[model samples]
Target: MSQRPTQRCHDYVQEVFAQEDEILRTVRQQTAAHGMPQISLEPNEAKLLQLLVRLCSAERVIEVGALAGYSGICIARALPERGRLITIELSSLHADVARAHFKLAGLADKVTVRQGAGMEVLPTLAADGPYDLMFIDADKGNYANYLDWAAENLRLGGAVVADNAFWGGSIFNPQTDDDQAMVAFNRKLAAHPQFDSTIIEVGDGIALGVKTK
Candidate 1:
């Protein structure tokens, strides 16, 4: 069967630049089997996150919105042996599954699954700051809030990376609440004085920002 252009390009990119291993495959399958949302992240996006972690030499990572530990595993895989990852998940079911996956991946010792609303849990993490990197992929409406927290808690040189910044191209539609929030978040991220930022077309869209102050 002929593949669509997008799929063809994606497949070629995966072939040339990305690799997905068995751990990630099992994580994906388990999410589906457990009736969790299949919005973990694209393979290339996961690889990009790993690359970003390495690029920043990140030792401590804070991940907001861990659906099933897929992305957390990706981040954890890039960390050094002694590095740590603290992920916030609202759903207890998701958190439980994520914990199991982390254990299966031998990352239970390095990863901490905090179950609660990201915004509520974020304040408690302040004492754990300043983190090396913060990855946001939670509720779209809280994008700005998450970025704000990242700006304050991340170290001066740390980076804040967010997924779904384009809101499925609905930023132009002007109808969805999520789209409106995303538009505001994108603008704020680029204009925020403490960070230099830009959004890239990866997976829906990814906002990358570095704390300059």
Candidate 2:
């Protein structure tokens, strides 16, 4: 069997297809400098997000996590001139940092950084939907809940993309609530009658589902 993607493979893809620009680099640096967890999506993964956004012709996007705006920049860049993105972050500190980065990327006009728990803020956004796409990358335990919301709010033919689908390989033998939640999230998304879904083996893993019915 072919070997799974390794550090070298990631490095090669980063150099060729996912090189970070100055704005994105600064987001990463400032995220660490602010003592936040370095859990932002890999550059390659961000690139995939960009592709997915464009593929779905997404104009209104919802990001369940805004970690310093690294991924938000990528998602926003792929949007049309009038497109908009609303990203949610639990920490005020992280939200502030992301707002700064979004402004730095000259995307403040196109992005809104919401500071609150995902479930709390998500309901308030219903008036903005059904959104074209929704990206979930926040608390593991609430992934399925977020998916449920997406299923209800996403437009027909829209998409729901979740990060950490593999949960660091723990899905196979879930030992914690978070791991079990991810396992259930993956299963539910894949089996949902209204959606067609699959796991794309990128950084950690990416679960992508499209609303079909």
Candidate 3:
């Protein structure tokens, strides 16, 4: 039998992410129109990004994936007046589309899309940054490396968000490669002393880790 969402969960999500401005709304429409997959962050994820931005009041932020520029726009919209977001996208073509969306959203000044493999791109990204926040939403096989690099780059008390952790609920299964990677990553994070994390089921799943020590 399929599980169903509780009424409280439904209501809570709606109440939390109800606020949407014209720019954000426009970007959402554009993502759909681009003929790309619905790879954008959902309303709940956007709300989480909004809350995290408010909490950090971040001047510098980094994101591992820039899929259609959806989450980047949401996060960029929340940054402080002078805040900036550095987003990495694997595909150059997607980078171009993302740039167009940022222009449409009027967030070009606050967000930059870097085109390259994150493993190669992340190291060269500002070494001075003990960034306030790091978001990893890239290829699943790279999660372990991404977490390692993010841990080194993030400031103490900073947060790292790893998306698609539950992998469409396949995380409990033992056979699939994606599930295995997620399971291993979950274990790595849970055992690491540097971070305290909670697995949250929003959209698919997100793992929020707070840097410690």
Candidate 4:
């Protein structure tokens, strides 16, 4: 029998394990004030991202989306002093906002905000790898493409983590193109021969795969 978390359980986890600091709170609030989409990861999910980074001992990280730098801060915090993070954002305004947040989080030295579409920026980043971790949270339609890139760029033990794996429960019966794309991405990640993958029932679901080849 599968046991899902209750609202109270979630609250407890947030209170204990995912409390937001002043810097993170400011990032979230300022992003909304700047009229950007308030779609960055929740505190719990941010904590999970940090945990995944530390679990994998990730030092070189690539973030496909840099929305106000909320998740970037979390990922950067988990990295060692010599760690580096390259985050991509399509909107210049959002990229600027994320850069400010990264500075505020005291992670400016650790992060590089690349202002471009994921597909366009990813190719330019190949020489920087093989990266230790790649986090996907950008356009849903291009998720599979990003995973394909990760497969080639990540080291044998590196990890690929994608958000919105459940697509708000739409993966069960995909109707829209985005839904279908997510389903296909999930299936491909699960069946990929070089990676061991699983979906963690976090906020919106997080699909995690570790390369073994």
Q: Root-mean-square deviation of each candidate, in angstroms? A: 3.3, 1.2, 2.8, 0.9
lDDT for model 2, on a 0 to 1 scale?
0.95
Once fitted onto the true fold, the runs of candidate 3 whose alpha carbons sit more than 4 angstroms away are: 1-8
- Model 3, residue 182: displacement in angstroms? 1.2
Candidate with more favorable, higher TM-score: 1 or 4? 4
Candidate 2's TM-score: 0.96
lDDT of 1 at 129: 87
**What is the full ranking by TM-score, best candidate first?**
4, 2, 1, 3
Q: What residue runs in model 1 are displaced by over 4 Å at the alpha carbon?
A: 1-7
- Residues 1-213, candidate 3: write the lDDT tens digits: 977788688568767665567776776777677766677777787777768777877778999888778888888878988999999999887788889888888899999999999999888975668898988888888898888987898888888888887888788875777778888888888887899988876776788888896
Worst 10 residues of 1 by lDDT: 3-12
List, residue by residue over 82-199, the lDDT tens digit for candidate 1. 9999999999999999999999999999999999999999999999789999999999899899988998899988999999887788887768788899999999998999999998
Per-residue alpha-carbon lDDT of candidate 4 for residues 1-213, written as tens digits (9 for 90 to 100): 988779899899999989999999999899889999999998998999999999989999999999899999999999999999999999999999999988988899999999999999999999978999999999999999999999999999999999999999999999999999999999999999988999999899999999998
Each model's lDDT comes to 0.92, 0.95, 0.83, 0.95
Clash list (residue pairs), candidate 1? none
- Candidate 4 displacement at residue 184 in angstroms: 0.5
Worst 10 residues of 2 by lDDT: 2-11
Runs with alpha carbons beyond 4 Å of true place in candidate 2:
1-7
RMSD of 4: 0.9
